[model samples]
Target chain A: MSDKTSRRTPGPVYVGLDMGSSRSKVVVIDEAGKLLGHAVKKSGTDFSRTAKACLDSALEMAGAEFDDIAGAMSTGYGRSNVGFVTEESKTEIGCLAKGGYHHFPEAITIIDIGGQDNKIIKLDAAGHRLNFKMNRKCAAGTGAFLEEMSARLDVSLEEMNHLARDAREMIKLGSYCTVFSATEVLESIRNGKNVNDIVKGIFYSMIRRVLEMDSLTERVVMTGGVVAHNAYLVEMVDEMIGRPVLLAEYPQLMGAVGAALYARDENQSAGATTAQASSKGE
Target chain B: MAAGKSTTRKKIQATDLMNQVMSDYFYHLNEAATSGKQKVAWCTSVGPAELLRALGFAVHFPENHAAMLGATRMSTELIPEANSAGYSPDICSYLTADIGAWMKNITPLSKAYPGIESVPKPDVLVYNTNQCRDVQDWFSWYSKELGVPAIGISSPKNVVEVTEGHIDDVARQIEALIPTLEAISGNKLDMQRLRETVTLSRECSELWKKVLETATATPAPLTFFDGTIHMGPAVCLRGTQEAIDYYRVLLAELQGRVEAGVAAVDDESLRIYWEGMPVWGRLRQNSDLFAGLRTSVLASTYCSSWIFPSFDADNPIRSMAKAYLELFIVRSDAYKERYIKGMLEKYRIDGIIYHDAKTCPYNSNSRYGLPQRVEADTGIPCLVLSGDLNDLRCVSDEQTKTNIEAFVEQLQERQ
Candidate 1:
């Protein structure tokens, strides 16, 4: 028996924990398969501790305790670092795909630009994964690159997104290497180029680097905290791909939402198995 | 470094035996001069080991030694030594690492194990262009350095079918090599001995094919990582009775393991097939990622390269030429895909992991559009991973883990 059985509550809730590289997120859903509560916290050195804290906060927001959660599932970089997840944990790819499919029931390609890497996932009409591609050992287009660029420009990351909108002329940065691109960003500054234009150029280059990873399908769904925080990046992606990009509901929480969805499935299946066994006994 | 968490996964028994056989193989080669009977011939991985063995030569594959250098984490120190020489960083890593090992006079194997040189010096060198042109250039440089005569065989490139004419062409080269080999070893090439050597070579290939086929079982008893090491005898001593004996022992152990419901990966949840050569320096790191996910990379094209379906001992040179020339690596993309699809079905492979080696253009050249084509045909997901065979700096461990996690997720979604 799981911890859920030991604490047995009649409320029937599902919990999801997404222990990411930068942040950990938790989502709680009720028996009706409706979102009850969610929480996000920074993922420090102790991923498990951060996950537990996020789960506790989510449970509290739902006006419930740990006993109410019938099942739990974990996803993301620190997924294996967690302890209380009921089912075998999923990878971010599966969670993102499920989340993307739940919102848009069509053939979709998800471009999840996370902290350290970018993933291009293709899904069929039935939400089955057709194929996927990830950036090759490079951090050029990731949030980490943007953060490094922000540090170099001496501008806040939140301010950098809005700064791109003020640019009159876009100065395209060339190098894909983060260190080289940082030097190029500095060189543009020395050449009397406007900071706004340079920042816009950085965004354009980041989008271009991701576009080069793999060809996208007709319907593209963008996810992850990078897009959740920066709306301008989504518009840039929309213009570059010449298609209106679909965003997941609570884009940063999509992985957690998907994990919660999987947890609900496990809980329902377990209930069905128990009911069938009791009926057979009758 | 991802936390070096010790896994409870059981080690394959054949791996230990393979390590012993490989260590003994290197020791014998180092002591060849003292033996006074066995001559050493430096050859390519896909070179004709049977012909060399028929002449009583201890065949040494430099590619195998280069992989060992990469696996033992010595490539970083050695690759630069060759880069300082004429060879650029973009050249095939096997060439750079092997040349670099010679220049630096250091090998991780030598440092770890006593009384064993990394690789034995060659009395003669053999070059074959069946796989890539790098072997030709690599062997030519060593031939010049060691003052030994070099024998060359160039197979037809980009041909759909390897014809009798092509076989005859390669066979003529094989016949030409007899005089040079006979001159070095001070022995005549007996036709009966050559036939016997080819027979043993055929048996070894047959057993190797069976060993790889055994991985088709659910929760495979062996992994591609195990195959990479277990493949040493097939490459180094393919024509010898010793290699045949090694496979017999290995096949029995693996068979027993399968019968007992043992797995290479303890919790084999997904079965994947690996394509291209391993990222040797990070083998353990990459393997741990799969083992962590309960994914079993059951088979690979690299380990199965020695499997020749048509090795006829009745016609030695012609059969040998056909086997070497018909390798899937030398074939076109369409042919390669067809072979990959066949393996996918045979192994019940859930996905394909194509390792895109940065330094090896010849191997990874056609890999860009491969995943799309493979997915369209088989409906099986394919993940293209970027890493170098010998260069440790070319790949990122963190990014590789992320890619693997995502790929595993993709597999789970499909299931």
Candidate 2:
């Protein structure tokens, strides 16, 4: 909101704020692209609440105050209102592509799994972001879907991931959507297949769909809230694609990181411009 | 407009007056049929049977004829029949009355048409449901009553896409029905008749498709509603030579205009893609509104059914049932995705009009996320049109017209 570009103190940090459909995440990254702090809160975006509760919880965890932040970046479902800087918001695709680049410098493919949609972004080997594809316009093959299946199987999220990781044989899970996958998981249960293996098959099926979309995928990296919680997903994805995936240390915080980086750039420019004008006037 | 409003202002009540009148008329006609009700014909929607008669059939539309007699005017007089038939509050009022009338063989109006007894009964029931699916069951019910297997023709379901494979399959299914027709009607369908029917259906369909394609032209030469109703004969009388004829006439008129470079919606700028089921009850009204705004619906998933609805010309008889079953709506969502993508590409749809029908769940699946995908894929702005697929109460003309006006304005500006 400030027009004056003033130099920031050495300890000043920029923060990225992301409000997803299912949860909210934030990250503080200082200059030099080093992540300083990150935090998340499970909260629904009841717009009237203005995300005040989620923000407070995140700030307390990061030990960062409102003033210490020179500027803040925002992205995700609620990026338009993150209130850190006046910069216009980028699309989810743009944010994800930037996140993928920052996380894996050589990454050519980005797989973002969320509650309602599966997006497989394909980038040329040089990381120019060639093309991308999504699922059948449903919230299947996303993390929220996995949570629903895990509930139907009566398995904890941790167990769901572990079981999928341990499975040797993958059955064909009909689809990645909660509607169909739950039914297929139920069918597999009736067929006397072990619960964990069914879960494994589901994870594999999702990875396969992502792989199908990212047909030209090489060095795939995944980001989302589901990644940190479902350790098995990272492992199974590696097995499914026959390669290791570099998970974001804070998988859910990439959007936040991108936002913070944007905020940092804006803050530095503002400060330099203010200094130049002051010196000229003197 | 007054005539239309006054005509529709008949009894809002649910009674059997119209049905009784219809039955009494039908009964006397049946009684008069010394030649055994020769040349019976059934109709699809509520409209004139001129097309059928133009093609040579003793035509009758139960709904239209019932609507014409004005028995819906004194519906309360037949309350006894309405209650006895268990046509309670929940069902569509017209359907209840229609069935109530069909079940009985006496009505006060039967006496009105004094010479009706001399009129012959329908020997063949030609039921078409291109506008509404309810006619399928209605005509089937009548076929049972007449103790004759009615020849009912159905149009394909509307999905976002239709494929050549789908067309081939449907043709095969239609081809396979010939023996079944021989068994049911005891009249073998000649290959010549079948060929004629397919050729007619295809030409008419192609003309209709051309009409749709021409909307891409600046100042579209024809409006969508005109096609919606004109497309009636083609869908209902698919196996007949007349449907082909009617469309051929309509096609020539359209082609002449196109040659002269007439615009359906002159100064065409706004383009839209209809999503979900079409509200048949309000079909013409809505299409007319689009035409008024110079916003042509370049493509609609609903209209796309005919795009890939024919069967493989060769070996068409073996897979008839499978073809009917493979109708995009009945198939998996994978097929639906394929169907929609094709429409987006072929029609170059600028935005989606998601009609969200009240009576149809199949067409309204995953509707919420459709705007996101459509806008992302085709870069087309999309809005979910809130209304039923057929029911009129769910249709708010004022609200609909307002939203459409806004959509067209934004779409044009963006273009």
Candidate 3:
């Protein structure tokens, strides 16, 4: 049988759960580091319930049973709420860095614009984290800011993205605060500004907020749900920074994939230690 | 599957002695306020306690009282009151909280010690701008409200080196204060008494420095949180035998812990240097957080501010000026970088956490690209925590915990 076919009849699988503020995500991977399946859903108020549901969906898609999980790790804002995780929970920053490095495998800065916070993590060529910074105690440049702005502009998030892409001219926003920007958005509407231009302006404001947080490295990788939905933002970043930025294949599931990678490595290390112990005893 | 363990670090035995020392200090201040037997002089914490003591005035530090208000979780509510009274929220929270407590006619003192109705009424107010210009403004407001004489030494700031000229200027200012202090205390300035008080302060400072130096030991026996509480006597009772005696006991206890190889935090693998003012209200929370992470914050700029090594009893005036001007808060960025690098080597620090306190810009060192510079120079990682000395509103406990955990993970990755 082929290795892929053999893996499909899985004896064991590793799992990673990212319990974020807005959405919960889970990824299942086999011994060979091949992604088997993944699932994402709204986090809502009950994190524990949402985490369990995501895990169940991911496992179902992977064609694996509960007994097949060899190891599991949790991460994100609600990481501690995931009761099924078998190892110590990791921070979203470390997980995102690991996930981004797994794809790029180069010196790069990872800009993760998440639901509640934005993180800029710089890594060396050896996959070592050189430095990192998170947004200060504010939601000015995060996914929540976009969501709030969408509601204020009376447009669906997807429509906002489309409008931003089709804009003839970008309308620049003056306020960095979400509340203040909402007032500015109303004024733009009163001035009979094009909705498409205003939406592009909101995108410009969000990009400006993240860019101003820290200087970007030569190789920048953009990830998270914000980038997953708003592909136009990558183009905007390219135009602003005068360089192209890489996008993760599975942006929203990067943290979950990173957690799975950790679980796989840890389980292998434990197995190797046990094997060495057994040989010494013999 | 399971939650992480909570911090279970053993409390230092010296804490009990610190409590007794602080209670007695407040009791004396209460006596001065109520009985009017002694004139009460409100001085800044880093201001000249020796001068006031020599002039026969009972010294009370409003900064210390403001710290108490923060520790007791009263500052957050009181800060807004000061803001409503036309004081901007961006000024020092210590100033706002103290002035607000005054406006509300309440003091944590009354709750801590029996028969203490309020803070001691100041007969005169004195300040030094070595720490920040805020102290003068903080003291001036009270001086106006109470209709008392206000005087201050306008020391030069961002001092790279405390030159002879700087010492001369500050010394002349301090000497000029003798007339007003003498007028308030109804006593002549006795040079002999001033020398004796300066001698006592020097002795107390040396003992405090030695106590802090004990943290150089691997798996430090005491953390910065311990020093913050135990520093009460050094701040309030300096220039008195009480502070000297208290430090001797505290130092003995710490030395015993070092001999026994007892660590303040269990499995203490990471030694961190805290580069700014503490989140005063969350001392216990922050302490437990670091301990739970197996990280010991062994040294800090805020706690080390009281260790005036240049104090000379022989040349009291000049030495006091040099010592106060040499404070970490008053130093330029270049000087601060060198000092922090020395501290990193001294403490064997694995990381640096700079608190960017919202209100106290003078003490917040992270805003000026210092963290990146320090990290690049030392090749040791640095994390900046956003917090305030007195305002809990400026702090986010969840965010702080996440950032610290990630920073620790990065340090571990380096290892």
Candidate 2 achieves a global lDDT of 0.56
Worst 10 residues of 3 chain A by lDDT: A1-10
- What would the per-residue lDDT of candidate 2 be over residues B53-95, giving only the tens digit for each residue? 3333444555444332223232233323544766442343344
Ranking the candidates on DockQ from highest down gives 3, 1, 2
DockQ of each: 0.34, 0.02, 0.48
* CA lDDT, candidate 3, residue B217: 93
State the displacement of the C-alpha of residue B19, model 3, in Å, after optimal TM-score superposition. Answer: 0.8
Best by DockQ: 3
How would you order the candidates by TM-score, starting with the best?
3, 1, 2
- How do the residues B1-415 of candidate 3 rate in per-residue lDDT, one tens digit apiece? 1233587769888788889888998999999888999999999887888899999999999999999999999999999999998989899999999999999998999999999999999999999999888999998899789999889899899999889999999999999999889988999988889899999999999999999999999879999999898898999999999999999998998899899999999999889999888788999988988888788999998888998888887898888898889998889999999999999999899999999999999999988899999988889999888889999999888889889989988988988
Candidate 1 CA-lDDT value:
0.83
- What is the per-residue lDDT of model 1 for residues B1-415, given as tens digits with 9 covering 90 to 100? 1222345656766677777787788788878844656898888887877788788888888888888889987886788988998888888998999899998787666765587665677888987888888889888888888898778788777657788888899889888888988999887988888899899889999999888888988779888988887888888878877788889889998898889888888778899989888999887777777887788999898888899866788999888888988887777777777888999999999989888898897677335586678878888888888888999888887667767877776777667
lDDT of 1 by residue, A1-282 (tens): 112323223387888788888889898887765677788888989998898888887777776788777888888878878776553577777777777888888999999888877888888999888777778778899989999999999999899878998889899988999999999999998898999999999999999999998888769999888899889989999998898999966788888888888888877898899999999995
Which regions of candidate 3 deviate over 4 angstroms?
Answer: A1-8, B1-4
Q: Encode model 3's per-residue lDDT on A28-48: one tens digit a residue.
A: 889886788788999999988
